[model samples]
Structure formats: C-alpha cells, structure tokens
Target: MTQGSARTDLRIGQLNVAEGPAFEEFYEIFCEALPASERKPRELIVALATRSDYYLLIGEIGGRVMSFAILYLSDRYPIALLEYLGTSAAARGKGLGAEMFRAAIDRIGSDSLVIEVDSDRQDSGDLEMRRRRKQFYARLGARQIPGVEYRMPKIGADSPPELDLMVRPGGGRTHVTKDEMAAWIEDIFRGAYHRAVPREELARMIQAMPSHVDLIP
Candidate 1:
C-alpha cells in the first residue's frame, strides 16, 4: 500500500523487489549512490525485503524516484535501525532526504531510531564529508550518543572502518545506560549485519566507549 504525507511532494511506498526490469533499474540507481561494500547483491536485498523485520521504502516526486531508505527492526527490542539512506544525484541539495528520514521515523513508530555514521579517520580523506553527513542527521533531530565507539567490520581486507552511533528518540523511547546501549548496538551488528562479534572484541569495543549518557546538542 502507498503511504501519503501532506508535508511534502514525495509519495513514499515500498520498493517492488521482485525480479523485474523496474526493480532492477531502481536498485541500480540506488546502488550507484552507495559504496561498493554497502551495496548488496540483488538476490540478498530481494530476500531481505520479504522479511518482516526489514523494510524498503522509496520516495518519488511527481513520478520520479528521488530517495530511498532501508530500515531494520531488531528481534530483541522495539528499536528500528536506519540501515541505509540515499538520494538520487539529481535530488541532492533538496529537502527530500530529510523528509524521507522523518517519514521513516513516523512509519516505523519506534521511539528510538539508530543510525551509524562514519567517524573521522586519518587515512580516509573525507573528514569534512563525514562531518557534514552527521550534521545533516543532527539537523533532522538525531542526537549522537556520547562516548560510543563503533568500528565497521573489514570489507575485503580494507581496514576495519570506524563509525559513531546516533539516535533520534521519540516520545516513548526508553532511557538506556551505556552498557544497555552497547548490547543493543552489538545486537544490530550481529543481527542486521550478520557479523559475529567475539566476546573479547566486544569487551574491547565497549571499553573504548565512554560511559557517559550525554546527547549531542
């Protein structure tokens, strides 16, 4: 079913992931905007879309596809993970991305929505780009969790990518401590990303994280 919102011109709905020409084109465009590692093969995304825990939302403006968002609902908690969000090249600089984000939050009905942002890295030269990305989310009301340190698993021998955790907590969101947050974050890595975090590695990551509960203002 197509969902409508009066606040914007874009119409949001689920992407048809069935094997077909239209889906192929849509996925191709979406994948082009993302990194090679982040872009999954067609078969995997097709299977994921059929699962109850995953959602694929597309936003179209005047019949033109403009943005897409993938969300995952955790099996252990009533939390939604904003797995990936991207906008068509032509649609950048407009407010479509932010609108799509707010729509995802509204549709999921989850008070706490978690998003992973790449942390500044010395080897990677896109420090300003990374900062801008996080700022965009912050402007949309998402707050970075203080003291959280996340490292993305190595992709094909490249260094283990580091990331930061941010969340937009709605009215019914529960207040969790550092430990609880770490567990939830780990659950996302294991459940959504399918990466097993060893006990020792988990301990190390948690140790690197701050124990404070402050939110980015």
Candidate 2:
C-alpha cells in the first residue's frame, strides 16, 4: 500500500500442482468477485489445470483465502498479466487487495502489470472507481497504457464489442506497436481464457482492439 514492497510472493508459486481440483474450485469461487461480464473464459481454466503459469496466490490473515489472484504469463513480452484479481466479499478494502497486488507484482518486477479496466469516455461511478484503482496502482509506480482502449467480448463468441484494455507497465515503459500489443492480448486469451478461447477467436478479438501511445515508451 505504501510502496511496491510486497508486489508478490513465491509461496504460492511453490504450491504443488496436484491440487488441481482445489484450484478449480477456488477458481470458480474467485469468479464471484469479478464483474459478471468480465469473468475469465473456460479455456483459461483448462490451461490453468494443465499448466503452471496461473498462480493461486492466496492471501491470509490467519490461514484462509481472504483473497486470491491469477497471474497469466505472456508469450511476446517479459510480463505477467494481472489476469483475474479479487478479495473475498468479507475482505474488501482492508489492505488485503493492496497486499495481494503488491505480492504478485513484486515477483514479476520491472515487467508490466497489465489489466483491462472498463472504459469510460464519460465519467461516472465506474469511472470514479477506475480513478481510485489507478491511484492504487500508481502508488506502486505502475503506468497506464496511454491512448489505449481495453475490451472483452461476450462468451462463446469473438465479435461482441470492445471494452477497455487498461495497462500498467510496472515502474517503466513497456513499448509495443499496435500489431504487437494486439498479439499480446491474443496470447492471453489463447493461453488462459476461461473456456476454449481458440487461437482464431483470440485473433479476432485482438484485431479489433484500437492502437495507443504508451507512457512508458
């Protein structure tokens, strides 16, 4: 909360993969905290079950999953997408969110801590929360992708619509061309979408994203 001191923890990274069932259950439970429309696709679950990139980072005050985070690795950049992050309903705003984010970002130091926030060209309640969230990340020295727009389409489809692709290149500039940035997102969907976000589907969505001028660049 004060600084990027605890951006991540290797404790969960050290977790054994045999807990796939538990991981899946936790994955579902974690979904409740995310915006209903922003849930991770099913393909991501399969990838998480089959691969080890997804971190079931559990935050505990006294040995409980007060909060959890899913960190998705990237193929094109030396970064980890902050993917799905949330605290338990009973645990919001108690510094648990900050600590969880810090612990994760700390491990993947210097690389971007990218996240897609809902876009708002018009200020509203959502925009206010976005402002607050941005402030939180700013405290950790992360940068938002300037001129960039983030979006996620409807489930089982590729051409729903665009939302907001907010980015935070941690403590530095993480430059990428439009083609490169779009591919970066496609990489995310293909690797860890909740359902089977096929390569083609991911490609379609990525192709639809708008270009931007990144601050870190």
Cα lDDT tens digits, model 2, 1-217, are 1122243331233223466554554555577776656665655554564565666566544334466667777656766787766777776777777777777776677767677555555566678876677677667556555545455546543443334555666555655566767666666666655444455655555564446555453
Predicted candidate 1, C-alpha RMSD: 2.4
Please give, for residues 36-72, the per-residue lDDT of candidate 1 as tens digits: 6556656777887888988888887777667888888
Model 2, runs deviating above 4 Å: 1-29, 41-49, 123-125, 156-162, 170-174, 194-217
lDDT of each: 0.75, 0.59
Flag clash pairs in model 1.
Answer: none
TM-score of 1: 0.87
Q: Top TM-score: which candidate number?
A: 1
